[model samples]
Target: MKKHIFLFAIVCITQFIYSQNDNIPEKKTQKGFGKIDFLSIKMPETTIPNESNMGFTGIHYNLMMNDWSYAGLGIYGAVTGERGGFFTLGINAGIKKYFTNNFYLDTGFHFGGGGGKSAPDGGGAFILPHFNLGYNFKDLSINSGWSYVNFFDGGEIKGHQLNVGLEIPLDFSYADYDVAENDYSFDGLQKSNWNVNSKKSSLMLHLNNLEIKGDDTNKNVQNFGRATIRLAGFEIASYLSKNWFTFVKFDGAYDGIKAGYMDVFLGGGYHLPFNKNRTNILAKFGVGAGGGGGVDSQGGFLIYPDISIEQKIFDAFFISVNKGYVMSPNSHFYTSSYGLGLKYYVERNGIISDENSFSEGIFKGIEVITKQDLYFNAKRDGEPTEDMHQISVQINFDLNKNLYIAGQTSFANFGNAGAYAEGIVGLGMQTNPFINDKTSFFAQVLGGAAGGGDISTGEGFIVKPSAGFNYQLNNTLSLRTAAGYVKAKGGDLSSPFINLGIKYNLSFLKMN
Candidate 1:
């Protein structure tokens, strides 16, 4: 009996040793590192300071490595001089590859140029080849690069850039590793978790611009309006993480009336904490060239960065303060807009986990808004009109985080016997269903009501349904294409519209 008991103890000890060995992390002979890395570059600090001679200073980012690259499609403009200024607009694309540790080669191209009536008014393209050398020590990294810029018009600009930056791990590596080791932990011996409190930060230097877009319609005279404007020439900016960022933005818009050169703005602000999770908030106070158009008649250079807030009251309810200047060729104006927004999550987590569990859920939300124009004029063939006022409400709902429907109602009183009400409804679906994730399909159906007077006689309705698909090229940008049909009830009018646009995810602001 004693011999048998001793043998049992020896077998139990052997099984314990085997279990301990199984829990240890296996030593990988070739640990593959991430190919995509964020490299922060510093902007030029010294500026050729002169009120008339605009200078730029800020940080930029160059995201190119291992035969991979990125490009941005946007617009920019600036005003400089006493009586006349210049404007430039263009797009840029770049590529890069790393040959060894701390050594890489990069190439990029850009096209755009503008100036005053008598100044250099021309557009051209540029190609730049650069070299980068840097050391990445754990979370901190320092890098420097030199580039040779060649222009299509036989011009050349040589420059150098340097940057020192840090990256913080925003997730629990230990927890993640344990879960990964256990193959998603179906045995209940381990748990998978995410560190929601982790903060991701970055600082960079680069050239950038400010942009806005919208459309308006009035039923009194069967009139519709659409406008888009790009502000800021080539100016440097310092983007600090997702919470706080600042930029020294410039402006140059030339419509024959307010033609003058020299417009510069500089300022920054912090995110207002309104939501406990910090996913929603007010991004108030960015002092820079206020919105609006015309060379000299734009909003005052100082105190122009408008104030605004965005909040998610609940999963489906959203609110925002959409104020600021929307530049046009006629004059600089101010728009005060307050509205509620909504979002609904439908059918989330469609992919099955290793444990045969599928994580899925739904979300929905809404928003109401009213907007008024203050001290700004509408231009009818270069002439300014009285202040304009508009009020609108928008509603949105998601069925399974994949399918959604939206509706909007707006009332505009131009203060000229031109009061009208407009209503719109739409439906959309996503090919990929995930929160803040990308989708391949985004189809919609829309219908609207327009016309002045009582709802019976002078009432007109319009129906439009659109089908579109979006390919998220990356985390920050997406490429989309849409086509739709339009039909009217009161008027014998029908048409089709096709649009291809890019949408960018700006800093995720918070709400109170």
Candidate 2:
């Protein structure tokens, strides 16, 4: 397995190099739009053993690759029945056929990794395939479909059901990375239809210490006396105004509890600048659902409210300190937290009040990729090691010609441990195009949190080093493959993994 992994890394580099040559394939800058789907599905049976009949709430963002097809990300959570905290998130792609301007048939499938609330998610793998008929209106589309939900590992949950959805239009802007790199004018960006308030955005990393409050009477786990839970995660925020912004955060446990404790939050905030625009005060609030690790938050509804102070430490970089409280109103968990963070501004292509003004993400290249991972000899503390499958998304930002920074999140989709997840960030280096611009290769090292699904990821701290090949499909898309090893800190988890992915190149720039 180790030798194969090493060979795979070499092949990845070879493919990536060949894919980037000037002679391979060329395409012009293109414009595309996407849609967001708010949907629901209900199983056909009752709760528990009859885990059928449970209703799930879902959301998907599909980016149009063309008029009739899209690739996107989706998430679903149990809203009705006894499994309130059961959820899954992963990658999806779909195709639509239009019989008329207003009528269409939609088909798609979602592969996600997440399980909670003692739900029978054998190792956290979930699959849903749907077929629907719809009528499109000027503003939105409505559809109903037949869906098949399968948790394909050691899980016993399977169902056929009817699903309904609402589709709303979303718009964004992009340009070819290679084109923009050679001739950036920052004009014509206004020509694309954008829907956001501004192009300004920030990526933040945070380390937090939480003091557990409340009793275990309402939670899935019991008897904790003022424990301290340490967590780390990342946040991505986009400004709606100069002082207002919306954000999403994901955090995982590293201490004070068994590994696998995690949460994801969405909210908005306001920033007040002072000290000659170098210092600011910010207030934020987030609400979301979470449960896992032995410290189960039954019914899984949580809220976080906080205030912080930020100071600009360098150009495009800021440092912050915050104090906050966390509570699960519907469950039995509460905590007070103190945190420190580092934030970097990134320019995005979006709607701006002043078209001529620049946002922070000026001259950069970005890559967003969706991946499917297969891990060999995956293990649980007391069980035999087995193979596991996971779904993940990785975002990369070019720091220089041969180097890039990357962040990734992954969830187990087909393994013995359901509700298993991971989040990591690190740096990578790529070789120049080889094999006639058809392929290239690269390698990276990442460190972050992992735990859940009974995996022995001690304290949820881990490091992964990987190497891969990139096969350029076109100017803006590529096929990627990587092989890596994951080793947990102070834990008993070690595995070799391979992943296959689709990559999309994004350039947040304009040409003359």
On lDDT, the leading prediction is: 2
For every model in order, what is the number of clashing pairs?
47, 32
Least accurate 10 contiguous residues by lDDT in model 2:
20-29
The residue ranges of model 1 lying beyond 4 angstroms of the native Cα positions read: 1-91, 95-105, 111-190, 193-283, 287-292, 295-312, 316-318, 321-512
Error of 1 at 450 (Å): 20
Give model 1 RMSD, 1 decimal. 15.9
For all predictions, the C-alpha RMSD in Å is: 15.9, 10.6
By TM-score, the best candidate is 2
Angstrom error of the Cα, residue 285, model 2: value is: 2.6
Q: How many residue pairs of model 2 clash at the backbone?
A: 32
TM-score of each: 0.37, 0.82
lDDT assessment of candidate 1: 0.34
lDDT of 1 at 94: 62
